[model samples]
Target: MTSSTRNRLFALGALLVAGAGLAYVAFGNIGQNLVFYWTPGEMLAQGSKAYGPTIRLGGVVQPGSLRWDAAHTHLSFRVADTDQPGAPSVPVLSSETPPQMFRERIGVVVEGTFDRSQTFTSSRLMVNHSNEYRPPKPGDGPDKWKTTVSAPTAEAR
Candidate 1:
């Protein structure tokens, strides 16, 4: 091969290797930052494999299972797969105050790690509101929606 051709080939091979290395590093960082959300049942199904990495748990807060400290610094609750009765639930403990919208039977996503004790220690809690807009039921009366809508203006004096 000619000297010019040999130098060109060497440069092309170096470019290919550099591109591959760059792609590898980009994907490696993405894989490390990709967090997954799992339901209680799904996480429980993982058994011992679920204990290490931080994961988001999505579910409904089980009714009557919430216990909050007086100072509002600590809270614990059981999260169920769904609002339906008898659904599987996992206990969650969070150091932060529950959001104002957080309430029993509402959907929530808690981000944290599951410990050997089977409790999820969450560092963040997010309330998941339904996207569907529901209108008031028939015969519910306008009073039921007073808080959601502004009152009608009285005639100007």
Candidate 2:
């Protein structure tokens, strides 16, 4: 074989090895890194298998189950796959203060570990929101925020 053919063969072998390494990593036991989040029902379905490893729990906030102390430092709420009352729910306790937009019936993802006790202790709390934005109408007032912004007084002018 000519020098060029030998070099090409060596390059092909290197490429194949690199590809195999990547495949192993992508398909390997790195489950925790690739998984984004699991729905509440899915997590619950895991049964005993879901007890360890920090995982993201994604679901809707269960209405009437959200509670926060007066200081608002700690929060507790139930998450379900949907806003319906009958959906499977998982109780979650979080130390992080909720975002301003967090509310019942909204999508949320909490990252934490679930114990055999059936409670999820979350270290981080995130509120999911749509990327779409619709600005207020041209003449719309501060009512959009449910607050009043008084116009500049004539006396000050």
Candidate 3:
């Protein structure tokens, strides 16, 4: 081919190589950076492939399922997948102290990996809160509730 034609072909090949490099950098080994979150039901559905990397499992803390070790301050509880209603439970083991909002029937988010024993070795624990809150009215200041409601004076009438 002529010199100009050769230059054009080289430019096209360089562009193709750059595009492929970009694609590999973006999509290659994506699993290493992915922090997946799923419920107990989803994890169970994933079968044995759910282990290895870190993950998040959320569900309500089953009542009477908590077993605390006072010596080590380690706590274990079963998190039932609310989606399945009465589905099988997944156990969570945490060495950290649970949040104050944590209680039976309360939602919890556990971050860790699930082993073959179905036990989630959590590195982080978070307790979900209800969406209910009482705020003061517009006219009511921060200390308005503390103010006494006095009767109107005769002159003011």
Candidate 4:
């Protein structure tokens, strides 16, 4: 109605109810979908604060730290702040097959949870890639459809 008092009170009540619904939604479930991205160093610095939430850990895959199970079904690797050997590293375990582009000393981003034991259990693995297209090797033979397998190079990574 055009009545100002009733209109104002109804607006205030609706605002309060909407706010409460948002808060309830946040507390009940939306929090799980709120993924945060962090580097190995930043995650390590969070200590206990970093555990339990789904996180997208972005960093370089540590060279010589990648291991695959005999069946190749499980993969374990350490991610570092940089390609440097001694940078802060976060141990990751993934049951999912890694992207075809997965390799050591390359940029990668893994999504999963950081458990209390200090290891990140990844449900997803992704390799960081360049945005521009570069010519393939001069004599390189036909690969797997350019290995449309998400295989990438370290040029712009």
Return the TM-score for each candidate structure: 0.62, 0.64, 0.59, 0.64
Error of 1 at 116 (Å): 0.8
What lDDT does candidate 1 reach at residue 105? 82
Which residue pairs show collisions in model 2? none
Best by lDDT: 2
Task: Please give the CA lDDT of all the candidate structures.
Answer: 0.80, 0.82, 0.75, 0.80
What tens-digit string does per-residue lDDT give for candidate 1 at 19-78?
A: 999998887676544545788988899899999898999999887777766565678888
lDDT of 4 by residue, 80-151 (tens): 999987899999998887766677777889999998898999999888875866765777654643443232
Model 1 clashing residue pairs (backbone): none
Q: In model 3, how large is the Cα lDDT of residue 107?
A: 84
- Prediction 3 global C-alpha lDDT: 0.75
Q: Hey, what RMSD does candidate 4 come out at?
A: 7.5
What tens digits encode model 3's per-residue C-alpha lDDT throughout 1-157? 9999999999999999999999887889865546455778878888889978788988888766766664636778889876345766798999777765565678888998898887999989988777977777788775652332121121112
Q: Clashing residue pairs in candidate 3, if any?
A: none
